[model samples]
Target: MTATQFRCLLACLPDPLTARVVRLQRYVLVSLDCTGCQEVGVLLKLALLSARAGDLPAAETVLHLAERTLRALAGHDHTFAPPRITRLHRPRPRPARSAAAPSPGPALAGQVARWTGTRPLVAATDASWKRGHGGMGFLTTDGRWGIGDWKVGPQDPTGPSKIIITELRAVQLLLSTVEARVEMTVLIDSLPALSYLWRWQSGDVSALPPGYEAPHLRLLARRVADRPRLRFQHVKGHSGHLLNEAADSLAAIARRRAPGFDVEARASDLVDSFLTSWNQQISA
Candidate 1:
């Protein structure tokens, strides 16, 4: 069947039935000897169709099958090669930075010298999403931290996009609490959030996804533009990074609506030890 016809048929069926059909089709396609380019195209369409039907497992299975089929076909047919199946969305090429763009390190140092006249503070930020609610947390080098939560709105993008939005919200919350004149280095785990910040820093405001007009995102762009002393660095999540782990735990606590703990609490003591060890390591 044509992809259009298959999609129309899937639209008519109930979700459970559609999922079963998707699984069955994946099995059948995997078993077939798909030698021709047209057959490979059909498999690609089927994979896309399965994904659109919300049968992600079946879609992944079909994609693997398609990849294997293409590889086998390539061994015999020199004219045809498989395309990269994993990269569903190719990123747009970024323009080169203009000569007027300020270097982050030197520019931040100059700003700090003119304003704060002290060393820049280091901070790590993290976010957690559960049950349509997002919690954000940030911990600074000075042993200060903050946690906040946001509810998912009807206007916000759902699914995977929501996590990216939440990550951005975490940054926005951090920016709101901190003084703009204070030179600070913010560490985040989300690449998409960092990408948006970097793009905004380069004066490219149109880099955000189409139809993604979150108010917090606009505010974040403006704040980042205004504060040239703010430097963003990426930290890998779930690693043994002390401040990141503490920030992550705080975010989880906020999201779960757990009991509040004072600075002398057990969690605080643990974080204090972490900070001490981190400081010792840095000084060493």
Candidate 2:
């Protein structure tokens, strides 16, 4: 079938179901010679449906079979990008100044007074920074884990290198791994990350960090906003919280696995200056 015909077929399916299927089928049909090949087409669709329904392991197994089947029929190398888990991105908020601490308010005071609660689903998150790239991870009380790393793109030399971005990303990954609408407590050791979340939760956007990471922080806040019952808890690192220690270990591993490059050392100095000035101004 033509690409248009295949698209029309996918359009008839439900959105969530069609999205995953489209990822698999678009690559197979457009990149490979799969026109009029009913067997391979059926296998691709089955894999897509299974993955969309949360049977990811089964879908991967079937996809391997389909890959072999396609190679047997087409007699050439064929490949498709594996499906990626979707994260929520919505309700984008306006960016504020870089590393700007919110003016002293009752919300901040209240958070300090009322920061004692725990849930069964506990996620302890941490980040490790190198010169250019950084790694972050979150480990739950129940053994679920999410780990990842980010680095400045060689093409984007102006990117910020603050470690708080990695910390925020770890919280975002932890929240994404858990079910939505379920109450969960996230323990993070970064004071800046915790402060940012408290400010965002209080709807005080003016009191957000400044820099290239401001918009990304706003994005992370939007995800937290969706889960009204979610809570952020500050925990001291290296104080022997096993889950936090595990997350720290995972983050270190990810940092080791991250690609090494020449890090621009001046970024940290600049950020420190900003923080120092901001703190002085707040104190005055």
Candidate 3:
């Protein structure tokens, strides 16, 4: 479907979850193939597009499938050729300063009233694309665990293998599942991912410069952010942490499943982060 029709059709769905995914099937995943970064581009676009259309549920479904498919193919020795970026349809490159965009999650109250037990289970995650690496987590200020996702891959720029594409897919998994809700802070190591999410959640897509993934990032946030409590924070990368390690492993595990549908919470300790978004929406 054309972008205009896709957006209009989604506006008619009503339910944030259902409309979001249906739009993904129509605009993002439907045209995606087993090729290169186009899949990544489509996945990223699916996310922001979902946000714009306010169909987060459907967006989450598509995001999960995209991430799973990307990781499943990550180990192959062959470099899957991707489509070239045509001047007619290319997006602006990400700014170098975007990397320095600090996360505001750390500034949060840090005293999540739910963590009265004294120990915060925090999970920090990272992902790479064309070496496009980014990370985040679900945790408490005291290092407690929660629901979150991350990945490492290449920069598709305009193709399917882009890292943000997988990140969005992972975000969908964290939000769409039945077990993802709870009170927790999600710490991400990637600035691009964090900035896009932060801006979108705050209701401002222009917060970051115009990048290919900007539109997708905004959609991803809108799809999940209307609800309060759920937050994204930036963390230092390559740090040694158990929950973070587990998230990386879980991402790969998710890929073994077909198209990332029917996926459930395997990392039970931190599924709470995922829940906060949906819960707030439900209550709203």
Candidate 4:
């Protein structure tokens, strides 16, 4: 998108904050001779820091600055390039380096908040153990987040097994702790949890493997699933998203779970998204 068109996208903002912020960014880029992608990468980080509050306008202005810098660098080569903003997985209101290590539970929540900037998000995640597996059901809302992570070790090794049971525990935590009567979205990386929500919502309780019980979530799903507002969305793991990255990093530190998520949702992704949107406009 051209600088002007990108500026127009800030219509989503509340007031003149977009203009003021954009002007600030332009001033910052006044110096610096752009060349390799290294310079663009640095500017992109500043933009991500600027976008921390979910201010789309501030983000756009920051983006416009990046674009202008790139155009100057690319010279005769296309002036308007796509924005490649990367996302970070940060705890909500990222704490100081000293507090970076949070108890697994709160640590995860903080990581999620830092990413999406939402205080509350439902999560369905599973952990693999030597015996079997464990799953967690967590909700972050209204500035407070809680989690119930349950792992099922090698047991009767029968129906439902550890994964299902652990997942059930997590789901219960979400329904029981969340006080809001309204539906909310949960971010999860587990397919089992997603299918579980779908099955319970659809009233296919029998779909669950034998010897297992959903307890409260099955009922909760029945009531909230149809609300159209309550739902869960899956974000690919290790996608370089700021919060996602932090979550994975912390999880790695905690569980030593290696072979991290594939897509590392970095700040560049956001920049890329901006550039793609910008390019579309320019080419259009």
- Error in Å for residue 257 of model 4: 14
Cα lDDT tens digits, model 4, 1-284, are: 12322232332234554444454333232322324334554554455434332334455676666656655753322223333232321112323433333222211222222334333443333333233323242334222222222334355433554554544444444444444465576655557767776776666654554565434344445544544556766767666433333223322332332223212232123323433443355468
Better of 1 and 3 by lDDT: 1
Q: TM-scores of all models?
A: 0.52, 0.51, 0.38, 0.37
lDDT of 3 by residue, 1-284 (tens): 33433443344334654443443343242343335435644764565445433465656676676555555655421223343434432444533434344221110011234533532334344433322333322333342332222333364342543565555544543443212445545666667767667767777744533345434444546655664656777666556444444455444433332332232344333334533542355469
- TM match of model 3 to true structure: 0.38
Which prediction has more favorable TM-score, 2 or 4? 2
lDDT, residue 7, model 4: 38
lDDT of 2 by residue, 1-284 (tens): 33533543343344565555554574435323234334566777666444433345666677677666756754333235443322321222344534433111000000111112323666678998877767776655444555556665556422453687778778766764566776778888999889887777676644545555334455567656656777888989998665566668767655654123211122222223333443355469
Residue-pair clash count for candidate 2: 6
- For 1-284, candidate 1 gives per-residue lDDT tens digits of 42323443344234655554454343222323333534554665666555433355666676666656655754433223233222322323445655554211000000111122224588788889877877776667766655556676676553457777767767765665567798899999888788988988888766664567544466567668878898999999998887788778867755654323332253355456666777777779
For all candidates in order, the CA lDDT equals 0.59, 0.55, 0.44, 0.41
Top TM-score prediction, candidate number: 1
